[model samples]
Target chain A: MTRFALTIEFDGGPFMGLQRQDHGPSVQQAVEDAALAITGEQVILHSAGRTDSGVHALAMRSHFDLEKLFDPFRLMEGLNAKLRPDPVAVTACEVVADDWHARFSCVGRRYRYLIRNRRAPLTLTRGREWLVTRPLDAKAMHRAAQHLVGHHDFTTFRSAHCQAADPVKSLDRLDVRREGEMVIVEADARSFLHHQVRSMVGTLAMVGLGRWREEQVAQALAARDRQQLGHNAPPDGLYFLAAIYPDD
Target chain B: MTRFALTIEFDGGPFMGLQRQDHGPSVQQAVEDAALAITGEQVILHSAGRTDSGVHALAMRSHFDLEKLFDPFRLMEGLNAKLRPDPVAVTACEVVADDWHARFSCVGRRYRYLIRNRRAPLTLTRGREWLVTRPLDAKAMHRAAQHLVGHHDFTTFRSAHCQAADPVKSLDRLDVRREGEMVIVEADARSFLHHQVRSMVGTLAMVGLGRWREEQVAQALAARDRQQLGHNAPPDGLYFLAAIYPDD
Candidate 1:
C-alpha cells in the first residue's frame, strides 16, 4: 500500500463543504469520484482543516491510501483531468510515509477574511468578498483583534453546532490591516473552534464601524458564553489559506 | 435634457460586448433597459472604450441623456437596484455638461491583461485570467514590450476587421510586470486599433516563454504583416481598466 499527500485549491461556491455529504456535492466527493474513475479504488480522503459551505481554500492539504501501485505525479495529473467542470485543482502531490496523516500531523493552520469596503455592489468579485457599504476603520479593528490573541476560552466566538471537544485553545496570531478598499483579517493557530474566525471578525467589524469599543472584544472573550457573541460573519468571505506541517 | 455620467464595473462573461448587439445582450443594453424601466423614457448609452466579448471592465466611463429630471445619486441607486441578478454595477454617477460625450471626449484608455503562470488549473480566477502552465520570465517580456512603446505603424497588431481610420498611432505606454504568479501587461494610449493590445501581449508572451528571441517582437512590428504576429491572445484576460479624461 502507498500513502499519498495532495495539495489542492478549490472554489467553494458550488460545494456544500470540503467533506463528503449525502445531501449535496462536495470538494471531497468530487476528488473521490475522480480517484474512483482513474484507479477504480474507493479512497476516503482526510483533510487537515474542515471548512464550511461557501468557504474557499487556497492550499488545503489532504492524504489518502491506495492499495494499487501508481506514480504520484500521474495520479495528480489524472485527478486534475478527471475532476473536469468542477472548481477543484490538485496543485502538488507526493508519496508520503504510511504514518504521515494529513490531519493529525498538521502543526498549524491559517485563515483570511476579506471585506470589500466599497459602495459599489460586487461584480467580478462577488462571492469572494463581504461587501460593507459603510466605511470601516481598519486600525480600530486591528486594535480590537489584538485582544483575542493568546490562549483563552473562545466560547463566545464558537458556533452552537461546533463539535470540538474543548473551547479552550491558543490563538497564535490575529492581525487586521487595510489595502485600498479591502479590509483583511488574518489568523493563525494550531486549531480553531467552529465559526471562531467569523465570529471574531464580525465582532471586530463592529469596532471598525464604531458600534463597539476596542476593549469590548476582550470582554466578550472573558464572558465565555455563546449568547454574548457580537456577530457571526457570512461564510462567503472566509478562506482556508494553508495547513502547516513540521517540515513546512 | 439631463446628461449623467457614470463609472461602472462589469463581468463580461454573459454579454456579447459593451456595445448594443443585434443578436445578444450587452452591458449597454442592460443599463439602457434599467434606465427605461426607472424613467419611462427610452435612453441610449455610450461608453469611452469598446470591449470585446468575454472582456471585463473595472471602471468604465459612460453617459446617457434623459428628459426626465432625476438626482444623480438616486439614479445610481435605482439603476443598481434595477440591474439585479446581472453582474453589473454603477460605482459612481454624477451630472455632466451638456456637450460632454462619453466616447469622443475621452483623452486616453488603459487596459491590463492578466496571465496566471502556474501548472494547476484555475478555480477562483478561471475566467478572470489566462492560465499558462509554462514558467514565464516577466522581465524578459517587459524588455520586449518596451520595443512597442512609441509612435509606430501597428498594422501587424491590428485586426483585419479594424475600423480605425489610421494605422499609425502613438502608444504612450506599454509596460509589463509580475505579481507573484500573475504576469500583467498594462497599456496606455489615446486610442487603439482592434486587437492591438491582445496582439502585442501575445507576442510579448512568446519572448517570456523563450519561444521567440527578444528582438523578435521588434521584427514582427516592422514586418507590418498580420501573419507575422506571434499569437493573438484570447479576450478572457483583457480588462478595460479606465478612461482618462482631462480632469482625471
Candidate 2:
C-alpha cells in the first residue's frame, strides 16, 4: 500500500464540516469523491483538523492509502478538476510512508481568527469574516491572551461535546495583532479540544471591550469550568492556517 | 431640493452592472430603491463611474437630489438596513449643492485591478479577484505601460461601444506592482473610454507573457485601431477604487 499526503485549501461555507455527514456536503466527501474519480478506488482520508461549517482552511493536510502507484502531481490535477465549483482544492500531493497519519503525525496546528472591528457592514468579505461592529482594542486583547498560554487545564475553553480524554493541553503561542480595520489572532498548539480556540477568542473579546481584566483569563483557566468563559467566536473567522509534521 | 452625495462600495458579482437594465439587477436600481424606500421620493442618481458586470467598487461616489431634507447619515443607515442581504453598501453620505453631479463634477477617477497569478485555485477570494494560472512578469508589464501614459488617441484600447466624443485623453498615472502572488494595476485619469483599462491590461499581459515586445504596445497605440489591441480582460478584477473631486 502507498500512502499519499495532500495539502488542501477549502472554503467551508458550503460544507457541513470536515467529517462525513449523512445529509449535507462535506470536505471529506468532496475529497474522497474526487479521489475515487481519479484513482477508481475508495479511500478514507485522515485529516489533521476537522474544521466546522463556515470555517476555512489555507493549508489543511490529509493522508490516504492506495494500492496503486500514481504520480502525486497528476493526482492533484485530477482531483482539482473533479472537485468543480466546490471551492476545495488539492494544492500539494506527496508520497508518504504507510505509517504516516495526517492527524496523529502532526506535531502542531496553527490557526488564525479574524475580526472586522468596525461599524461598516462587510461588503466584499461578508461571509468569510466575522463582523463585530464594536470597536476592539487589540493591545488589550493581546495582553489578556498572554496569561492563558503554556500548559493549563482548558476545561473552561472546551466544548461540552469535546471528546478529549483529558482537559489539560499545552498552548505554545497566542498572539493578537491589528491590521487596518481588522484584528487578527494567531494560536498554536500541539492539539486542541473542540471549540477551544473560539472560546479563548471569545474571552479575549471581553478584554478588548474593557469588560474583563487580563487576569480574568488566567483565573478562568485555573477554574477549569466551562461556565467561566465567554461566548464561542463564530466559525466564519476561524481558519486552519497550517499543520506541522515531525522531520524524519 | 437637497442634493446628497454618497460614497458607495459593493461586490458587483451578482448584478448586471452599475447602470440599470431591463432584465437584471443593477447598482443604480439598488441604490435608487433604497433611497426611495427611505425618503418616499423618487430620485435619480449619477455615479462617477459606470462599472461593468462582475466588477467591484471600493468607493464609487454618487449624488442624488431629493425633494425633502433627510439627514444624510440617517439616510445612509436606513438604506444599508433596507438593502437586505445584498452586497451593496452606502458607506457615507453628505449634502452637496444642487448643481453637483457625480460624474460631470469629478476631476479624476482611480481604478485598481487585481490578478492572482498562481497555479493554485482561489478558495477564499473566488469572485473578488481574477485568477491567472500562468506566471506574469510584472516588471515587463510595467515598463511596457509607460509607452501609453500620456495624451494620445487610445483607439486601440477603447471599445467600439464607447460613446466618448474624442479618443484623446490624458492619463495621470499607470502603475503595476506585484504583492506576493497577486499583481495589482492602478490607473488614474480624468476619465476613460469604455473598456480602456481592460484593453490596456490585455496588451500588457501579452508583454508579460513574452508574446509582444515593449515597443509593440506603442506601435499598437499609434495604429489607433481597436483590432490592434489584445483581448479584453475580464471584469471580475476591475474596481472603481475612488473618485477625486475638486475643492469648491
TM-score of 1: 0.97
Q: Worst lDDT window (10 residues) for model 2 chain A? A: A118-127
Work out how many backbone clashes candidate 1 has: 0
Off by over 4 Å in 1: none
Tens digits of per-residue lDDT for model 2, A101-172: 999999999999999887557888887888887889999999999998999999999999899999999999
User: Poorest 10 consecutive residues of model 1 chain A by lDDT?
Assistant: A226-235
In angstroms, give how far residue B175 of model 1 lies from its true place.
1.7
Model 2 clashing residue pairs (backbone): none
- What tens-digit string does per-residue lDDT give for candidate 1 at B131-202? 888999999999999999999999999999999998998999999999998999999999989999999999
lDDT of 1 at B35: 96
True contacts kept of each: 0.85, 0.60
> Compared with the true structure, what per-residue lDDT tens digits does model 2 show for residues B1-248?
99999999999999999989899999999989988999998888899999888999999999899888898878888989877688988878999988888999999999998988877778888888878878899999999999989999999999888999999999888899999889999999999989999899888888887889999999999999999996788988899999998973
